[model samples]
Target: GHEHSLTGHKQRGTVLLRKMEISVAEADKRTGKNTVNMQETYTVYLIETRPAESVPEGGTPAAPDTLWRRYSEFELLRTYLLVTYPYIIIPPLPEKRAEFVWHKLSADNLDPDFVERRRVGLENFLLRVASHPVLSNDKIVFLFLTEVMNNLEYFIFFPETQIIALKIQTRFISAVFSRRFMGLKHYSDELNTIILQLLRVRARVADRVYGVYKVHGNYGRVFSEWSAIEKEMGDGLQSAGHHMDTYAAAIDDILEEEEHYADQLKEYLFYTDSVRSVCRKHELIQYELEMAAQDLTYKKQQKEELATGAVRIFSLKGMTSKLFGQESQEQREGRIAALEQSIQEGEEAIKEKDAECQEFVQKAWTDIERFKEQKDKDLREALISYAIMQISMCKKGIQVWSNAKECFNKM
Candidate 1:
């Protein structure tokens, strides 16, 4: 998640943010301050934090912070962020992994090195979210950075039902959804590219298969005609050099040709069916891609008509300012933060969709390659059988002609 969003930033030299250090330690077992009683000692990571904005006294906000959080706390924070920002593509957390080792009971999952690695990963995850223009202003994220997360509760709590109505405004939702919808359309183009490629490959393979089928059909026709001739001449030769042995030998040659023609027909039919089956499977994927594209386009167009800005009365200092409804600096920053979040979320979503489309196409191509290999083997086997039968039939024809000549000499 972080990779897609930042890879471009790194390349463009747009990634310049202050770094935060993270360190982990065994939780103090002696501190009898467990709100939720635990059976065993756990670990926690200490995060470096800074104030959200300037202070009135021009001092750093809450220096020497108490921003220590455990793994479960991190999980809780992630869950809250997902619920709160359904429109944003939040960065992923490190997996809780259990690794095994032979002969020795592996405790690597709880090992210091392992915990340190996880801490670093978690810290980076937060940093990525913080660097995002919109996610940086998220209240949950602020708590993750500023306070010791002791209270296991909701990230954004509403005082009442009325507050809930005010917390997520209609305009805010419209802005987020609009950006997300546009992001989907932006990435759907890549899926379209993949579908086109698959079609081209299918077409090319069909052309070659059809060409082979035509040749094999003609060969089969020749064999059928020879078979008919042999059947008609079964027990007699109508010509002056007529002989019953010559008719029997012709039947043997026709039998050999039957094997050759059967093998050809088998290959032809197999390839034709294979082409249809492969195309049919991929066509379903194509349909899904097209539908996803259509859905994104429709959603984007619907929301694009809505206003993309947040508006609220922002006066907080003076009575006169409040009466005039003058915009406060904090309010302006909040609006800017909202806009920035939408833009960043949209970009992250686009990146995610692009990656998914690429992966899907890559898997399809891999499957196609495997299918081609299998079909190639089948084709090779068919050709080899035909070749072997043809050679045997040729030898039989030579021997039969020799006997026929002897018979003619005797006559």
Candidate 2:
């Protein structure tokens, strides 16, 4: 069913990343079907949106709008988008509960570091959606970015008419240009396995790396104490200790930066599910078409048997007919008429399902191609960045030790 658009405008806009402010508020929780419990201490993000810099000629640029959105709301928006556009690879949201967190760090959702990471992730999600060629034009996305709402429940409940029209147009285009395309089921399954394994191994490696850097802190402490008792080597030992301390302290910042790359990998990991969903939807349509064709074939066989007055096979209907006496001529004619009507309906259903399947496959394959290009570009950049960061960290470690060595040589 078509629904009224909240805002009539469908113009694409830009989402700006503004600083997130933590607000403590009482949230009403539904403990049961009719129960309302007050939950305290929830985090909300301050999102800002503005008209794109390249506004059309003679068009007035709208002032930036700021709205306080909760993390759960972001989850809601993502869920809505996934259901609405199953073919498109929707941007993944950050992990709501911090996983594989350092032992020293607070694992709580409201932890400052965790919240900050989530804020960055949420910002990226918005930017990705805004930049999507098709998603950017969606009214729901536009409303999510620009509209101020006291209650978010009302926001997604209404389906926009523009979206219905878009779907209709998409179906028509798909039907005209439809062709057989390879399914992503096998590809997505393999990719998911590889990504999960990588994430697991990377997590273990990161944990060990964290411990190794932190162990340097002990070396720094030991050197400082040794310097206090030394005569000729005191200054040199102290300088070396300082470098050790600096290297140890740098781990926190370095690891935090590395988390960003992990997030990028996680995005594609989540994307595998979306790709599989398209394949599953297509399978369902294919199944329906098969069922319809099978039903039609049975009806045709029944019509042939009635017309030929064929001897009864060992069947429940045939046995009943024998016991009650053969069906009258009018009864037989009526049965044939019913079967003929059913056959016609079944044929029509088969055609409709086949067309629907073709259209879906075409549309889904088109988006998959687009997503593949994007995935290649994004993963390439992410891997390059990760390599560079590792190189830079190693260089810094070398520089620290080299400086420590020079200090000892001067002594």
User: Residue-wise lDDT of candidate 2 within 1-411, one digit each (tens)?
Assistant: 011110111222223222211122222222222125555666778776554453458986555567777777788787678667766777788788876554556778767767777777777677667656667667777777778886567878736753554344334222122123333667788888887787777677778878878888888999899999999999999989999899999988877777777777777888887776566556555655777887888889889888787744568887787799999999999989999998898888888888877777777777788788777777777778778888898898889889989988988
Off by over 4 Å in 1: 1-38, 51-66, 99-108, 154-411
Query: For model 1, what is the error of residue 100's alpha carbon versus the real structure, in angstroms, after optimal superposition?
Result: 9.3
Best-performing candidate as measured by TM-score: 2
Any residue pairs clashing in model 1, and if so which? Answer: 134-341
Deviation (Å) of 380 in candidate 1: 40
User: How displaced is residue 18 in candidate 1, in Å?
Assistant: 6.1
lDDT of each: 0.46, 0.70
lDDT string, candidate 1, 1-411, tens digits: 111123322232212223332223223222334557755556666666543332447655455344567777777776566444433444556546522111122346666544644555565566556555456666566666666545757555534643343333322332212232344334434434543454345335434533443454444354445445665542222221233234333543343333233322332333333333223333333444555555555444333422332223332434555578766667756655665566556556556665655554465345445434543554465546556755764575566456546643543
Off by over 4 Å in 2: 1-35, 54-63, 102-104, 158-183, 311-313
Cα error of candidate 1 at position 247, Å? 81
Give each prediction's root-mean-square deviation over alpha carbons.
Answer: 25.6, 8.3
Candidate with best lDDT: 2
